[model samples]
Target chain A: MGKIFDFQFMIEIIPSILKGIPFTIMIAVVGFAVGIVIGLFGALFKIYKVPVLNKLTGLYVSFVRGTPLVVQILLIYYAFPILIKLINFKFGTKIDISWIPAVVFMFIAYSLNAGAYLTESIRASILAVDKGQMEAAESVGMTMWQAMIRIVLPQAAKISLPVFANFFIGLLKDTSLAFTAAVPEIMGQAKIQAGRASRFFEAYIDAALIYWGLCIILERIVAFIEKRNKESA
Target chain B: MSNVMIEMNNIHKKFGNNHVLKGVDLTVNEGETVALLGSSGSGKSTLLRCINLLETPDAGDVRINDYSFTASKINKHVKLEARRRTAMVFQNFGLFANKTALENVTEALITVRKKSKSEAIEIGRKYLDKVGLLEQANQYPSTLSGGQKQRVAISRALALDPKIILFDEPTSALDPELVGEVQRVIRKVAEEKVTMLIVTHEMDFARDVADKVAFMSEGQIIETATPSEFFTNPKNERTQKFLERYLQRFSYSI
Candidate 1:
């Protein structure tokens, strides 16, 4: 049997796929915002070599990086409640986390995964700052934290900007993985439409087109920021 | 009255197997400028860094004005206290590249000195003017010339109003043409009677700007005397040999 290509079917499913764009955007924005926060502390712990926190961060980054993100999402979505219930039973305390959405759990998993990657980028950026910068600040009686915040990190942030922008685009694409947890993001909506109409090719193509459009839009925003930063310098 | 601005006693430092400093004793009196004359790897920079606890000594004591810390153990409190009284001008002109010339001068004031924004800016401008970089105050280090950046670094150190200022070969990184401008700014600072410890290779500048000159060799201060006496009548054989070598290479007569 010859395979059939239907441009009309793809066009028809475009609006349905576009409807999931908001959720995709939400996951990307929230995951990245929270990921960067975690990444910064993870970076600082490693940079400063804080006693126990350093080792913990190292283990955490390794685990997240070594495991597939989909596995992490599945674990958080399916097993997280059982783990929490186990804690509640062990401590003889009634605790509930059922109110939270599966999408929330998916975001948490994605945040942690992104954070592990960002940790390396931020740590390298922080390292890329001149050693004499810290020494100069310290010579003027600024503490390490003060020196880092006031002198080093600003420069480091500039160095990490492009890397952060790339991660944001990557995160936007990765939100498609939220479909595995039935979060109704772009891929999830497309899968449902495809299942209903038995038009997998057209529905999936529609989803890919939407994601591609979003990424291109994001690239322009990143380019705008980089251009602005360069002009200011 | 205690006129001593910095007193480093038996300072010792080691980096791995390299014993960079060994029982190096140094003192800088208030309103005095002392130049540390030494060959490279003679522990001159290490000695200067120890005074500010930037390179914590393996052993000994450092006193900056009234604050003192024994280097036998961790004493962040005393180190910070001493650090507040001293600022170092790095050989590399370590002005924060991200900050403008004025911000470089104002950063420590607002954060460490707890000065108001207007007051800090006012003080920053005064020092920038002193270094003759007021016109370039808004410029970042990357855009400034080596001499201008060093001048900004000097202004930053000076603006802190520390009891003592340490200059770690401040003009060493500049081009020969740029060197004079930075040296002139340093000479102006010397005239201000701020206790200064300068580690320098420029014998002429040292003799002109330093009231006292101390020579170091093999991690020890081999000779210390008034600039006139040290240059005219060298005491140690090592000091005489060093001066001869330095003079012959630089083609300068004492």
Candidate 2:
């Protein structure tokens, strides 16, 4: 009771927690990268009002946005085995569940979630671009798709730069949720260390510091990019 | 028979309940510069937009050179064909904000015309030089003056070598002092025998540069004639009132 905090214990466990860094970064980087692609098509479908895809994208976006991240992770994680079983039982196929990795589940869940939010961000950004840009491109003989790729998207990407940075940071920290699926990300490693040593406060502090460090480094890199972008523009 | 560079027949456009262009018929021959004059809400801009299919008309036929299509039946192929033959300079410059002046001029050349980078850049530079914007080639639209931006836009249009160039209130958004620079470039383009249709509020500029001045009222072209006859001996009563209203500001006498 006399010693309020354990600095030495926090230092001792930093290395173990650091081991989870790659998993956290991999999940977040891959999730966000794929999410951008999903979001782009989702936004385009909605913008162009593509018949069936637009409605499906809207339902997907709403489903993801309406639910919590932890719930989504668990739902998708549990749903997969059941889905695979249904497929195997219904069809004459040997679709083994062991082949799929747990990390893949987190990737799918996080990406779908990120994609929903990014769809709105990307859509608003695309809409925010001046109407004249498209007109000018079309006036010069570019088809709609050509104008979109050459003219509209670059400006929209620039407008959504800060949003991308913010969302990526959110995603990086959100990777801690991977613990629910027993994937042993940063928070999972922290929990293991705490249970082993019975020093919950120290282990948690170590995890928090690691997250803060990663966020600071990434924020600096994004700041540098934003500055360079401003100078060029 | 004058070789028609552009022929728009019975163009009708409606914005919700407001009918903007009502059965408008217009023709532009090769090497002709026609300036469209009208007060606000008179649909001059909408008429110009229909040529390139920017704003689709509710009903009409737009023929740009050999590429013509019925407005209601416009498909991707026909739209591109008509659009490729015509270019527009907007009131807002419409320069790609993300692109440098040179890239803006060369982008369509590389993408639409399938020109090589070196060739596109060369063509881009020549047009930029024509508009006197060659020195600002690397500068973005955000950094350039509005006049310079419009000059870049004009050069971008010129680089395409379209059958006709449509300018929608090009100088309307420029500063009072800057308007002269854009006007000068346009005057020079007119001298080069480029077929152009310019929508403008400047009666003096229209008179000075136009081969013919056409006055629009409500949603229709009420009068069209040579600048000399149109300005000096107007036939329509509405044209008399319209000119008097504009000329009154500067106490300009016809």
Candidate 3:
């Protein structure tokens, strides 16, 4: 074999991959932030079973979770422009579809997928807060909602942090799919550079290394939070 | 003539096929401490919970300070008025694990009474100090001992300045040594002339502190008397048997 590894090849792609880091981090951060909100609301809806809204949230979670992230990215990218046109027709006005819309669509897809899993995790942790604690709050003449907000949710968040952190890391990795919509995130930029230079193997390896580094950093943060929670508990 | 603080008239509660409280009637006068002594599943806890509307009674009326809470004939406004005057402390220390001891105590004062944070904190600090936990004000419940947590729960109830406090076996979860600390805090509150309805098995504490004692058996009050009267000369055979069983089981001669 010529060379098992090529240091020069790896070194050449470093600057190009570094250039895409901001985009990669942006997609991950935005996707996780949006997903957390959706997950919290979705979990609350399922917990309370708020009539029609509950059923709709359940359907959204199942639909998003049942399909693959790759398929969702492709569908959101392709359907977004057409959906905007239909909305324009109904409203009797034109609406432009742009990069922001694509990013938003990709964010929604990733977040909702993360949210479905988080909903279950959050709901379970909320239940684990103990029934006696609730009874005690009520005995003190607190209304149901007040007790849930002041007493229950804070404790539940402590329990939910680990699972939430795991979902965030997974969401970060899934940002690779944003490349399909020409979002030009790290993976997409690496692929474009590799195509131009005919160095596909080198480029993909760089992408893998970048992803591995991010996951390691995220894992340490999650571990630290979990340790703190345990010490407090 | 003692002014009636709380009156339960023919209160009944049923859970599916289980008849928990069968027309249980009890009353406590203003500044009176009534100990509801009973074996497990005798509807003692259920009666206390019903007074605060934590568990709604199926039939009969609970009147606190002349405000009837029975939903049968009274309007919604009347029921809401009565619930405001009562508060409960649970068997397990129901301190909010997330909040500091001071925050948990002041929450109701801020939310319900519309007291400012500074004012609520002042009131909360007084009650916490009364319970001997003012130093632990900033500590969360998860860090406290069983007795300290229960004391915080007591302070939370007292911060509302409720007319009546219901204690549902407040010291049941405490270590044997810690039980006395909680009992002393409760005893101090009793001395302040706060009307209380206590469901407990702490016979000596109940005997020493209670103005009246009501013994319940199979969802009914089988005996009601002053502590001396009940312990010395129990009227009903059921009360006699209960005293005998406990006195023998714990090997304590009364």
Candidate 4:
């Protein structure tokens, strides 16, 4: 307890945690890409108020947004498989549905969580585009969907870029939750290393530093994109 | 007889209880230019927007050449077909902020009209040249001056080669110094015999560019005549009063 600081131990654990960086980045990229697709269609449904789907998507976003993401990960990874087993049992069908990868479950959980927040961000950005833009697009014979995809969405993308970038970096950090599902991302690797060495503080500090460095690099990328958008606009 | 380019009958529109437009009828012969002259809240813009189905009228039937659309039961196919024949230029320019001037002009052609990209670019360049904005084709709307933005909007509208064009106070949002450039473009389009319906506050521009002028007050067109007669000898007392007030502001007397 007297010797609290351990610089040498921290330096030693850095390489072990660094090995998890690629997995962490991959989970974030795949999860966020899936989220962008889900979020775009979800937002469009809500924005256009498409019958029952709109209400259903609203409930989904509200439920996901209302719950903690960690709980969602547990529910999706653990409870979802049980639910599927129950359905198969009730139907009396021999379906080999248990072969799905743990990584897939982690991806689903992260994407659903990110998508809920993205729905609101993307919807608001689309709304922020001037209503006249839609009118102008339609006047030139663009259908509602065409106008949205081409005119409204392109402009909305610019408005929502900064928010999206922030969410992306946040989602990257959130990949640590993948450890709960045994996905072996950054936190998973760090936790194992700390447990083996009994140097939890040192290992955790290295993990934090890695996250900080990655986030700083990502922020620069976001700034470069924002600058390019501004210049072209 | 000249073929009818546009016909709107008994158009009725209300924003809740505001009653912006009520039972308005307008016809535009092919190649005719009509200017809608009215003060704010007079529903000139609403009337123009109804033709494109931007603001669906509460009750009306609109015919643009072969396509017909009824407000009560809007047929999306017919509405789209009708809208394809018309273009609109907004007071705020309404150029796509994310697109370059050339892209703004070419987007609809490539997407809705399904022209090949090369063909769309060729047409877009032609219109940009026509508007004298060829040099600025690669520039985005935010970087352009107001006059340049409006000109680009005009180029975008013109590139579609619509049968009719609607301008809702195109120059009203421009600086005084910039208005002349847009007006000159409009004058050139008029000379090309494009059917246009413009809602404007610039009385002199209206007189100079409109083949016919219609004066509206309280959601009704009180008078329609040749621009010369409408400006110098309006029939309705309301038209006279409105023009007098407008002209007086500019230190001109009828």
Best candidate, TM-score: 2
Name the top DockQ candidate: 2
Candidate 3 on A1-233: residue-level lDDT in tens?
Answer: 27656668767877887777777788788777766677778878988898997998889878877898888778877887898889989998766776354567767667666777777777788888888777766666567777788878888888788777877888788888888887777798789877876777888889999989989998998899789877765
Q: What is the DockQ of candidate 4?
A: 0.81
Considering the two chains of model 3, state its CAPRI-style docking category. Answer: medium
How high is the lDDT of residue B123 in model 1? 100
The regions of model 1 sitting more than 4 angstroms off are A1-3, A87-98, B252-254
- For residues A86-125, what per-residue lDDT tens digits would candidate 2 score against the true structure? 9999996899988998999999999899999999999999
Residue B10 error for model 3, in Å? Answer: 1.8
> Candidate 4 regions off by >4 Å?
A1-9, A91-98, B252-254
Model 4, span B171-230: residue lDDT tens: 989999999999999999999999999999988899999999988889988788999999
Please give, as one word, the docking class of candidate 1.
high
A64-151: candidate 1 lDDT, tens digit per residue:
9999888888988888889888988999878786777778887788888888988989999999998999998888998888998988
DockQ of prediction 3: 0.52
Greater-lDDT candidate between 2 and 3 = 2
lDDT measured at residue A20 in model 2 versus the true structure, 0 to 100: 92
* Model 4 lDDT tens row, A1-233: 45678778778777888988988998899889989899999999999899998999999999999998889999998877787789889998666656777888888888888888899899999999999898888888999889888889988988999999999999999998888888777888899889987888888888898899999999999999999877765
Q: Any runs in candidate 2 off by more than 4 Å, and if so which? A: A1-6, B252-254
For the record, the alpha-carbon RMSD of candidate 4 to the native fold, in angstroms, is 2.3
DockQ of each: 0.82, 0.90, 0.52, 0.81
The CA lDDT of each predicted structure is 0.89, 0.93, 0.83, 0.89
- Model 4 chain A is weakest, by summed lDDT over 10 consecutive residues, at A93-102
DockQ of 1: 0.82
